[model samples]
Target: MIITDTHTHLYSEAFEADRDEMIQRAIDAGISRFFIPAIDSTYSERMLQLKRDFPEHMFLMTGLHPTHVKDDFKDELLHVQTLLKEHKYYAIGEIGIDLYWDQSTLAIQQEAFRQQIQLAKQCNLPIVIHCRDAFDEVFEILEEEKGDDLFGIFHCFTGDFEQAQQAISYNMKLGIGGVVTFKNGKIDQFLNKIDLKHIVLETDSPYLAPVPYRGKRNESFYIMEVLEKLSGLYQLSEKEIAKITTENSKAIFGI
Candidate 1:
């Protein structure tokens, strides 16, 4: 069985100590493919190092994360552009709005999101969205920018059925992660109704670990927890869940 963690920050400082072991554990658990999302220029080294260490299993994306947008965002975008020109990337991501943290930068954040979307198109790659309490804002940009040329995953999707439909309309797959296991996660209630083909599994690791391991640092192997929940939701076997989600991920990352 093969499982794809379509979204994760294995390069995050949270995994600085035992990143190698965590990755091995995931590989041992049948969680092999990992799509790495870039946060900013600061993490480029760690992200690249992760790919070097796991060349066969890792794919990389370049972009400035929404939360990283600040007064010097123009400079950051230039840095992102430089990386895009210099390296091969599967997507432009972990980029979107995050109003949950602060609303003051909504203007700059929106601009950055739109600019990144344009960059993704220019790069001829998909995008991975990171939205938090900014669906309307995110949707507005998606509506304005989406096209047959643009497609990707809505990473860590935590919205309702309607939002899911909207994301699908924009050629975006819903990335299912640790939230499905939460008692109040809410996604579980409506997720079964969505087509499994439109869903992909992820841990968003070193964060958002599934139940039993909830509130703890997430690991890719724990993707099995997501698989178990999805199997029950789809009435499919774990292997089937693994195969289909992996294929779905391959479609997006083209790996």
Candidate 2:
């Protein structure tokens, strides 16, 4: 029963002290595949270094995250293009609208988001969307851009039943993370409407830890807690949840 963490910032500074040990913990717990999403050009070097450290287990994706879209976004996108041309990555992702922090960048974020979607289409790779308080806006663009040619996962998805179905219609799988385990996290209510096939597990570590550690920094090992919750929701065994979600992730990442 190998579990795959479909979205995680393992390169984030939050794990400096025990990064190696934490990864070992996850591996010890049977969480094997780790999908790494790029934030922007700035972190590309560090991301590459991570692959060097764990080539067999870690997979990388290249894209400019919406939150990182600045006045020089065009140039940043160019960097992403160059990086893609130079090497291979699993997908184009962690790219979407982030209106929670600064609404001023909404227009630019959408523009960058659309551009990255085109890039993903061009590369024939799936995407990992990072959505915040801009679901309507993101969905609007997805509605326009989605097709057989456009497909990906909605990373850290916590939307309602209707929204989940909408994302599936757009050829996306919902990335279920720690939020589903929270007592107040609403995805638990109608999650059964979605099958394990349309779902993938992740940690998004150093952020959004599951209940019992909700306010603390998250880690990939905690993904087990998410699997435990899903097992209960689907009335399946943990081993089955791990295998199915891992298979769902391989369907996306092609790992």
Candidate 3:
């Protein structure tokens, strides 16, 4: 019944007051694997410290997030590249265009996304995409870059069935999270149509918490709530859903 949270900011300051206890709750619930995504250089030091503290449980990824892409994005990309070269990370990820925050940064966001995708290709690592309000633009770039070498997880995916198929076409595994538990989340209606193999579980904690905890600060332990929801959607037991999605995470992260 081992569960893997493929997308979580366990190092986030949101859990500063009780980080250890919060993580312990997940561990006790069988959510052992935590894949931490990099936002930028600002969180790099903290991310590394988390890895050091939980080496066996934590897998780190290095990349500049879309919303964090600003005027000095080039330098940030360089920092990501330097980290990739000097250290080992599971993926180049949580990177993509995020027009939800600021449409003005679209040009730079696209450039950063493309550059990071190229870097992922060079490193032979999968990417963890963070698309928001820019699916068309993101797909356009993915179209230009699609190939045997391009593969990754569409992190925190909440797209339609057709869009889900489209992401799968790009060799992406859809990352299902707390949103699936929401009454109006929508994706739950057709999620069973997509095979579990094409799906991975996540919480995106300190963000999109599941029902019972919706709108509240999310944590990894709440991933179990997500698992329970999937169990119903797929007509499988919680253990089975955990196993399938953990395997799916392994397939993407290569853990």
Q: Tell me how many residue pairs clash in candidate 3.
A: 0
Model 3 agreement with the true structure over 115-153: per-residue lDDT tens digits:
999999999999999999989999999999999999999
Assess each prediction's global lDDT (C-alpha) against the native: 0.91, 0.91, 0.94
Give the lDDT of residue 243 in candidate 1: 94
Clashes of each: 0, 0, 0
Residue-level lDDT tens digits of model 2 in 1-255: 788999889999999899989988998988889999999888899889888998888999999988889999999999999999887798998899998988999999999999999999988899899999988999999999988989889999978899999999999999999999888889999998887799999999989999878999999999989988999999999999999888888888787
Which stretches of model 3 miss by more than 4 angstroms?
Answer: none
Instruction: Give candidate 1's whole-model lDDT.
Output: 0.91
Q: Which candidate comes out best when scored by TM-score?
A: 3
lDDT of 1 by residue, 67-169 (tens): 9999999999998888878877899998999999999999999999999999889877899999999999999999999799889999999999999999999
Model 2, residue 193: distance off in Å is 1.2
lDDT of 1 at 111: 97
lDDT of 2: 0.91
